[model samples]
Target chain A: MNGSTSSQKHPLDGLLRTDRIPHIWCPGCGIGTVFSSSLIAIRSTGAEPMKTAVVSGIGCTGRGAGYVNLDSYHTTHGRAIPFATGMKLANPELSVVVFSGDGDLFAIGGNHFIHAARRNMDLTVICVNNLNYGMTGGQAAATTPYLAKTSTTPLGNPEAPFNLPLLAYACGATYIARWTMLHTRDLTQSITEALTRTGFSFIEVLAPCPTGYGRKNKLKASDLLKVYQEKAIVKNGANPAETILDLEQGITLGKFVEYDRPTFAQNYKAVTSD
Target chain B: MEPAVLTGEHFLNGDVACAEGALAAGCRFFAGYPITPATEIAEHMSKRLPQVGGVFIQMEDEISAMAAILGASCAGAKSMTATSGPGFSLMMENIGLGITMETPCVLVNVQRAGPSTGLPTLGAQGDMMQARWGSHGHYEIIALAPASPQEIFYQTITAFNLSETYRLPVLIMADEIVGHLSERVIIPDSSKIKLRSRPRPKGRKDRFLPYRPGANGVAPMAHAGEGYMVHFTGLTHDEKGYPVMTAEAQAEMVDRITGKIRKNLDRIIQVERYRLEDAEVALISYGISTRSSLAAVDEAREQGIKAGLLRLLTVWPFPEDMVRELAKRVKGLITVELNLGQIHLEVQRCAEGRAPVVLVGHAGGSVITPEEIVEKIKEQVG
Candidate 1:
């Protein structure tokens, strides 16, 4: 073997299903780590592989549906939640998971994500946030931090990024959490707990993209992860209205909000059912 | 033995009959929004699918409606959606995706006027060409136009069969006039009907190309989660269905989709002929407008103009060859429709310069009377 091949590539073996690896993600991408954490979570929950359906939308992460060995769907961008909601309602016995990027979930599919959260449809949405559009080169996105350079935001971006956890909590999601790829084990635990949460659960994973946003911003993937580790604060406010996230430093990470109320589908069943 | 030959009575609109037709086709999932003229189809489906252990959902929009049906179909259930003009437009992108991925599902468009919302509750045959070319890029579709309530009941079954057989989207090209008009329909026993399920690759495992064209141009469908690594895409794909963005792959993929309908023309094309032989002049029409054409032909015959009607039952795989043959024997062809001149052009193409073809139509919210068509026929005769 050549010296180039000597470095260990985090083999996503039995846990990640090596057969489907050499994934369609670009080199130095963070979506693979997000995907691996999701796999680990699904395994920890002990959900049957055949009984789970993985739904995704168009983007770098959307290809997760094809790469994973399960009943998966590679669908249109920003619409995975609505699609998975239908599948869950069709057979409530099966577990449905949605994996997609910020663009696929927030930009094109913002309406669906909120509605699905409101319904509390017993579905899990794992959104991977890489700060910029990773698939079409490094471009500024709704999730990109202020002043970060992107293809679209050449000099400096003026728009503020969306805090996905805060957005989901406000939209009536039963369970909401935010974790970073730097904290792999914690991220996997967050996803696993969200999966078994029994209501609409939303988990946002902040991953470092050394290639797209990183290279453009001159931040290496490892350096970006270190920045997150130093500045990250867990969101733990009792009231969702009082939730806080740092702007200049870094994003807050952890279970930001959780509340119990009659979810959309559950409350709907009470009145509609005889 | 004819299993329990139970029949039901109905003085129902064609839209209601279409719901019964979908249920009879073993469709249990209905996803749609309530739109004029097409609302009854969704209404009946909501009640019937639940009674038969099926599911119905009112999606937020037509985009979700299309996506939901595709999701249901992937889960191994017969699913459908119904809408009018505007909702149909929202559904075009996913419909193209369905055509490319070779997903088998039926979409019923009870067409209304457009060029941008001409009429809401009114009728129009304007979506005929849109059904064939609305989605970007190239693909083949099976479309059935129904003339009355009974045809709606029967053609919906044909739509589902064609969808499953060809593994493509089948359009039920009903107009608002036919959709709203009340008529008697008899829904026969479900078992006596021959419902075709896509042939599974039996004994042979993993060797399934989800898009492999069979002799009849329809391959077997292995629903998702059946352990087949079925790769579906909207881009040009080869036999194994992995998208290959090459010109040669594009040529093969386009031909595979269009060739199924073109090569198996006989099975795809369905037309009903009236007085095709002895008539010197032929009147051609489809959808509810065909009803007016039928009456006009009768009145013309009473006037001794020697004109008869040719009704189009199958609208998509255009009956060009049939029109060519009939045009050879007839002196001329007159096309009548609810729209300005949609199917009239198809008739002209089929006539192929052998005989001159004339158009008799209105904008289609209100029907063109038989007297109006008779007037046009008499003018040609004189």
Candidate 2:
């Protein structure tokens, strides 16, 4: 069957590759739901998909660039930020979006992602936080919540998961928002907001890795997503990370923090003028 | 024409001129960390790019500098970086990235003594080999070796074009001697010289795949936000840019990228053959050392040595054919340069052991003398 056939009625129906589905992601693996939400976000941006560039570094979420039909750049692990920055700067008119994995973005690619945000570059970064490295069979990640069990962290995670939104907020991203796949609609809206925003926009999507992290935790992807559905508080109401905590819990993830800040493009323009 | 102005114009060193050349070429993005002899290019770019509507970022380190320029290139500006020896070594990963991704960019390497940080301020063409095989993967690069500030100015433009047209990074090997030597260069009008830009996808932008080759090996690139698929990875990838780690796919993928350069060698390889016809001896050289070799050839000819000169403008493709033909015509070939001896070996191999090869070499910041090269010619001719 043709892959583009699924979105027959929805604007994004033709945009997705459904046949590739029966996906590698487990149910409640927020990646697929978030992936669907991203399609929705991109569809809503009204930016010509043809003119958008999707660049990803290695990871489950890094695959986002591959699924998109537009100029999709799947670069080396942890280097997508620079590539995306280059693509955006090469053609300031194009909307550059980065779909990166937590390990890829916060660990290996941490420096570039932070600087790009600081530059308030005119691009959007959608960080899919599964809390562990699922692509590599579940290694501990910077975003892996504390006490989480994984292949490497079989004894439970010792380090606290990075507050990605707080990091981005501190790095000076103009738009910073937090959401989880359980709140797919809200996550999609946040992604849409990040996509449409004029400056550097970073959205932390607390996705679940149903197979690796979820299986290890004995929680199905759906169970964790339902946990998200039940536990997640609104940005205006509660923390986004706190909503994603385990059977025991810590941080929260609603729209944690956001503010107005001139982007790198504007600052660079000012630097050039001066 | 009017008598050549000989040296009245304000003289700028070749390395400095490379910076000016990049500025003249409309390069807006420069990312580099300071490194010996080549530091002048970065210093100049840092001071000058800001004067234009350009940006110069002194990366925390060379690796980041290399990564940043690759980033800037996708931003759709003519991007460049400069280094010598070790710093150039740091840039290899991203240099490989620029190649596989077909990002148009320039990397200037002012060769200094090598292997490690051998001679910080000293001169050596030791990087001739690394410039070709520095990155781990199989690929072909357009590396230009200029002898004068004037050539550096012109060649920088060519470097940009070669990079843009081929959608790959071009290396400028400006050895320390030439990079520091003062020379006069006339910045030409933009229209007078050739320029090339990567071809953009036609019809639907959704059809744009970053790694797909167009009529030429290089597919037109759409910058980020241009709404195209641009997958650039060090891994083996298909034209559509999805990762293909299979050996067959790797072979095909590498072949296409390297082949674009290898097959187009005739268009990329450039050499200047001076007085090779009926000459009994020929001296081959590049960079500032070419000047001293030219003088040596003239002296040897005045002494009736029947010596000629062949200066290489393009180094990486090696100009093997031209060197072979010159070897056949001349009884003996003398390769002279500032290094202990680098390009000479390349000339010898290209000669295919056809003739007696004399290597006139020098090292570690000292200029090779014309007298020394003439002595080599005398010994070879005799």
Candidate 3:
């Protein structure tokens, strides 16, 4: 429809449920960009599409699992990580990825996120940080920057946002990265790397919610992308503690941490053996 | 080599026997959090599961425990989790997910008294109704009540079989007394044990509709990595397992899930009758209360009153037809339970005023005594 004829197929057509298209994301929402990049990465990585399962919690990002042509699960709010953990441990051969929003993954599900990382479960968790609960009408989320105005924070958010990478690093994530929708190539590559990497790998995608956070902040989708393009410093291997997001100064992007550790399954086997 | 079935009479508690029962039934994955009375089950499972080449995880909490077992079940493993009232309350949300996803797993709720952590160490039959309607929304569930440690061992296996048969979560509702009480449990040989596995999907993997029910109204299940590419959700889904939000879709989906058990109620429901033939008074009970009612029936019979006991091994599916038939033959019925008349309400409705129904109930923290139950039987008979 967008300059492509009906007969001209999309590359990710086989990887998606095409009939469920005209997806619910609003125009200029960065979730589509991030989702498309993920599909491309999954394809590029040569991961068995059927053997890969995507699990998601409630929110717009959570809907990604539904449209994906994989063994996906759309679980309850704040529960994708635990559900994916189960799927991974139950069958170690399957590649499990948890894709959900900041609110769904860090608010109600924050405990699960930290614990899963702590346990170093073999999972790839992709948190699409839109900075607010977009599906619930742009309410303040755990990733909402301090002083940001949301529907629930009309007076300005009093709480400081979580430094997601730092949290993952503190909780013993074996691999960690942060990228923006503007960094689609890097983000996609990071996802591909995370999928192949063992143990808990976390990727935080700073996405724009044009209708939610953007509308409230007086920044359009283009303006949001411009901010990431102009202000984002590509700092590969930067210390996670130094990667705190400060939109007024600059944002840092790139892979931060990658190391080997005995995963939950490995440790479980080791401890259980005589 | 240790036998799969620990085939010998051993004095064991309900929680330990339950763990052994799960082992014998081929449950290979158990994820649970420790709570009083139910903690023993997890402890035993942690020691036993790995020895059998199975897995046991003490999850972060009850919520994750429930999710983990559901995940294990989806991956083609018979899985189980054990918890008490407070932990069971935490599990209600994901238990709904298990039901909606049609995942076959077993959950053992060793009952403790509670609205919110009411009594942690004490036993109560308060969760009987919760087991039926704990999770939100309308859906049918199978719950078996065991009166003793021996019964619990057998009932645990039965729970697994029913869960596999229906492709839904089956509950073993054991009270704190039964969970902690020790008694002789005779576990038969592994060859003698009946095990049920979920029916595998037929046809090509690509065309298989994960939610499409067969003639028996239960869809075959496919594991996660088996390349079925199945999509599961808690939302209202169609036969293809895609979310379909409409009144018609909701009706069809709800009916299929609830109707599967409702239509096959005769096969799912199990009741134990004792001397009910030509009885003037019937003592209806389940779980630990059935033990007391059994004693009460003996006392009432000694007093020359025609008394009988109806023990509900399967507390759900209500056993409505059987209750209705018993109501026509018996002049009066006394329902005994540790709760404040939870199942008594179901018995009353089924009696339909053909016979006077009375409730001998306790609030919590203790069991209803045999003397108290006998008194209720006398009052009902008089």
Candidate 4:
């Protein structure tokens, strides 16, 4: 064994509740990487970590709030966005970030997501699109790829998955991007950019739910990572309408949208102050 | 924009009075969806919250509206929401979250008749039991049944104070009649009004246990961005606010959530006893029904019946001990409400065969007449 002092620590030890370590994510699951990237991105923004709050809805990824060493909230199903909205609106000093999964953010919480984006609320939303409901053992989800086998969809899913970037763009999100867990650096960089933005910023991270989704589809952990490496195409400034997650087809990645708009807080202050 | 506390006598509806009460109680955040009878509360908050440097958001639905208040409360803002039966039903899930997390906030249910949108514009007390057990859990709740516009105003402030003191959601259960009825409401001076805040964490900022009980089984709240870095969750958790998936954890958490009010019932429960000093029979009621019961008491007294009215101010921790005492002394108890025997069941249970508890109840499209209550009182006395 290499000579190492017991006092030596991992860099993220300062930002994470290390006691809650040995996390619940399964082996080869991409959520850990995505979560780490989000943490790294938050740190990179140079924002006081104490002033940043993370909110999550119910799911495997929803547990992100529990592990973060910040003022975090683990809310009910499909409610992270609204909870964060309340926090942000109530105290404009706090930077709010929503970290949740596809079934949580898109399916059950779809209405909140659209409305938050529509209002141009000041928030950073990171959706880990594992393609299926990972917490309840791989059920079909709103982002489940068409013809993909899942617990609920034993014979392959019939519904087409959502093009998240397009949905985000349509809902008036000011910042939108997509990246796989394999592209850690780019994902981290995009999230850092999002954390610094004012309006509703959305980042969709394509993570693999190895045990729940990978095993059901007859794909190994390595196979999904390989697919991400080979299929993902960095297409900055591409129309969000064309960005879809299809393994057989090319997976569009990189920053799809970035612009400026008057945030909800700013509008309230402008009209109310004068 | 009006001042936060309009300190003077003014004619106001129950809904507007409730909004003014919230402002006077140091509520700096309001989030809600527009529902009939309760819509005026949200409208008033939207105009007033901004004026006081507070925040008001009209959320997507009742679920989110409930959630937003919880969030704002966690962020150290005294927050509230107003809704009717349909919306209150929608808010049930997040209300459970508020209980589990022990977040301090107020929920004003200006009730309308409904199993589902039963009567949008009319008033009903059918949501009384719902207010107590609306959220799916065994935890106890604090609810106030305001009888008039003036009472609703003061009770709204009391709801905020109790929520802050107990570190959980408090309910202002006003039926549609009181919410829409305009009456003379006296607003007291700001300095005269009492305000309570959740206890704050002291000393060390690091390793602050968010769920650790301070006094009366309530924990000190650390708002976001205050350097506490606290974690709060809907799941059963330990003192450190980390999720502990064990029966032991659930027992401890649920105990504190319930025990806070249960152990402090004397301070939490309030009842206005009218002519109960020597009455042989009693009329038990709350909210709009309390008004009718008061009139019944007077009419029954004039008719040579020793009838008294027990108006419930705080309904959830149902003045059980007092009811038990009254049941033994009174010949019988008559429960009056807009719904079919909701609080009547509670009176019966608390009476424990000491007295016969009868209900002068209705299906709730209109108010229960005092004559009906008088008849029930006369029957009990006869």
Task: Name the top DockQ candidate.
Answer: 4
Among all windows of ten consecutive residues in candidate 3 chain A, which has the lowest summed lDDT?
A1-10
Cα lDDT of model 2 by residue, A175-227, tens digit: 77777767777788888887877888888877778778888888787777677
- Give per-residue CA lDDT, model 1, range A1-274, as digits (tens): 5566546554545334344456767666778888888988888898666677788888888878767766677777677776776667666666788999988899888888887777777888998888888888889888988888898899989998787877898788988878887778878987898877788888888877777889888988777777778878766543544544443465667776666777555664554454
User: Model 3: per-residue lDDT, tens digit, B23-126?
Assistant: 99989899999899899999999888888888888888999899889888888889999999889989999999999999999999999888788989999988
Interface RMSD of each: 2.3, 2.6, 0.9, 0.8
| Among all candidates shown, the one with the greatest TM-score | 4
TM-score of each: 0.91, 0.86, 0.98, 0.99
How do these models rank on lDDT, best leading?
Answer: 4, 3, 1, 2
Report the poorest 10 consecutive residues by lDDT, candidate 2 chain B. B1-10
Instruction: List per-candidate RMSD values in Å.
Output: 3.6, 4.6, 1.8, 1.3
Instruction: Give me candidate 3's TM-score against the actual structure.
Output: 0.98
Q: Give the per-residue lDDT digits (tens) of candidate 4, residues A1-274.
A: 6557645777888899999988998998999999999999989999899999999999999999989999999999999999999999888989999999999999999999999999999999999999999999999999999999999999999999999999999999999999999999999999999998789999999998889999999888899999999998999988999886799888999999999999999998898887
lDDT of each: 0.79, 0.77, 0.91, 0.92
How good is the docking of model 4, as DockQ? 0.86
Sorting all predicted structures by TM-score, with the top scorer first, yields 4, 3, 1, 2
In CAPRI terms, model 4 is classed as high
- Name the lDDT value of residue B237 in candidate 3: 95
- lDDT string for model 3 (A1-274, tens) is 3665756788899989887887999998899989998899888889778889899999999999999988889999999988887778789999998999999999999989998999999999999999999998899999998999899999889999999999999999999999998899899999999988899999999989989998898889899888888889999999999986877789989999999999999999999897
Better of 1 and 4 by lDDT: 4
Candidate 2 TM-score, C-alpha based: 0.86
**Model 1: lDDT to the true structure:** 0.79
